[model samples]
Target: MMRTSLDQGTSDVSDQQGGVRTRTRAAIDAPHLRTDRWWLAPAATAAGLLAFIVYSTWRAFANADYYAAPYVSPFYSPCLAENCDAMRAGPNWDLFGGWWGISPAIIILIFPLGFRLTCYYYRKAYYRGFWASPPACAVAEPHKKYTGETRFPLVLQNIHRYFFYAAIVVAGILTYDTVLAFRDEHYEWGHMGLGTLVFLVNIVLIWAYTISCHSCRHIVGGKLKHFSRHPVRYRMWQWVGKLNARHMLLAWASLVSVALADFYVYLVASGAFDDPRLF
Candidate 1:
């Protein structure tokens, strides 16, 4: 009888507490164990985001050398203003013409930038990386009360779904840019080069990232009750879920691709390097 009682007692530690599990502190606290290298992720994220900001800001203001034959910097595409470049690539909206010497990218980057800034994953990332709001798991935030997304600026995050629509249009524009990259300086078909490949890969990354967005996934799948009745959305939902699973990977990949695409165009336009023709 004692042996059976001991075996039962040993097996059910959780039941001893009467189906309740509680930590009595009444406040969130870090673990007692040593935290090793907990700061590295946030530090690295800060460095990368800062570097991209500085470089992008410099390139945005540089204005010149953003266009080479058959290759325009991703940062400067849809160069909507007059005096942009000889390529005359886009619609030439020209709303801001040399006014304070702002680059077209200054005007154009807002939508796409807004999309990423309000992204759900990015919210978590920068919340930890930049804001250091609890920096990592089991860490404490600097603030006493957690305001979350209820405040003024955070309230604006609700517009991410709207931004997703605009981003799809922007992706279409980028796809056109990729098509243009396929042509040579003379606009002949059957032309391929390192720049072409770069643009191609960049657009693919952008599409993957954009398509796999949390907003995109929810729009495709959420609110559906009967999957059998909606076979198409169900299929799309399934595929997007697969991509969404790797959304973080796609986010960083697309970021790097954009920077590199712009840099490649910069090199060609500035006469720093030639785009090797693979045709």
Candidate 2:
């Protein structure tokens, strides 16, 4: 009776081991499509965005003449008749100023793009674009697992309100650049180059984007209980409300416009295109 009992116990152990091996093999062989389908849309979007970024950045850096030449003094002879010869010889290719020898273009490009990419709105868009194509028009489905982090770094997205302020300031600076492009370069209003038009469009795009910021909408709307009752406030809120409705579209277009503007400017400065006068 004891021998029979021991034999039965050994058989039970063997069966348990076999069950675990079968489960392991099944898991290893399972189709990844079942688990990875959610990432398809987002991954494709990200890849496209990355390609655009790489192409634009490469063009910006490769077009050396777009930037001021090395060792050129800021005090180079001011050209009177659209002659950039004297300016081209200057060492201070640094358009803005020598703040740690950093290029102003790098500074401007990094902040707005960085902030937008990290913005809560953008994060939501990216996540939905990736995991859920044709995102639910209204009702968003919740994720099965809360795999996201709960740390301060991630929580910093709350500072998007402050980033909105930075965006406005940057937009203002770009506007100033637009004005300088005409005034300093002697560009006639009607006779502007491809670069000038691109730059102007970029400014408009950025304006649309800035106006569509969540914080700007709230501030304009006067989020108080009796805000709509006030006439002036009501009108402003209505305007902001219209813009806020198209915020996502504005955001994407603005991004594209900015990159294209830079490209046009680079091409013009590099002599890839003749700077035609609009007038």
Candidate 3:
């Protein structure tokens, strides 16, 4: 996919204030230095992202303590593997073989992982935070060569639209998992607890993040020529646009909420704590 600079227009502007003329240029000269707290933001972002990756990877590989009665880790939901905990098993496909009980999360997280990895906001965040592709505003990047997302593995990012579609299906499945949380071990309805609340919040945040995706917005409205003719589409697009404005917030919030949801289930299943019941 071709990339265009969002900060393209109005690169140079002149302002007169306090009887002084000052001019600002958008593009900075290479190898420049400005003494400021430039590295802090990117460093913090990298730390947060790296921590999440490490934690999620550990949980994904973990085969135990992902389920309790009426509560399942979000990471291990839609459990396709046999030998999963009896309470957490979801449509077990008898996947893998004896001597190997793989976690379903290992297989299922790829789609949502790809969706987040290739997100527009995340691209900018990581490109600056991890890769240091100009680490921060007015800072020179570490790489001597810059090919951008045009070559080889970077080109794979073009498939993000497809990943967006996959994310929608995953969101649906997770939503269903939340609905299932309403039942107890005996399949009796109206069961409620801390885990149920966690799952409910997790699904809502995931839906918010997924539905507010730029790709979703584009798919819903990109080809339309007239907002006048397609009032319904236009209204939906408008709402999506409003959501898209806060996509980055939803993205991070959903990530944290989902991880918290999984960790909550893990703790309960592991007997670290008892899941308090409300009804």
Candidate number achieving the greatest TM-score relative to the actual structure: 1
- Over the stretch 1-279, how does candidate 1's per-residue lDDT look in tens digits? 344533211333332321111233322222222348988988888888788889888998888888888888878767766667767354245656655356777777887889999988788889999997868876655665678889998899999999999899888888888888888988777799999999999999999999999999889975588889999999999999999999988988998899999999889988999989999
lDDT of 3 by residue, 24-129 (tens): 3443223445678989989988998998999999999988888777787878766666566665334345565444556667777888999999999899889999
Per-candidate Cα lDDT values, in order, are 0.80, 0.55, 0.81
Predicted structure 1, TM vs. truth: 0.86
Worst window of 10 by summed lDDT in candidate 1: 13-22
Alpha carbon lDDT of residue 106, candidate 1?
A: 72
How big is the positional error of residue 214 in model 1, measured in Å on the Cα after superposition? 0.5
Error of 1 at 191 (Å): 0.7
Ranked by lDDT from best down, the candidates are 3, 1, 2
TM values, all candidates: 0.86, 0.64, 0.85
Tell me the deviation in Å of residue 73 in model 2. Answer: 20
Candidate 3 has what TM-score?
Answer: 0.85
Each model's Cα RMSD: 7.2, 10.8, 9.2
Task: Give lDDT for model 3.
Answer: 0.81
RMSD of candidate 3 to the true fold? 9.2
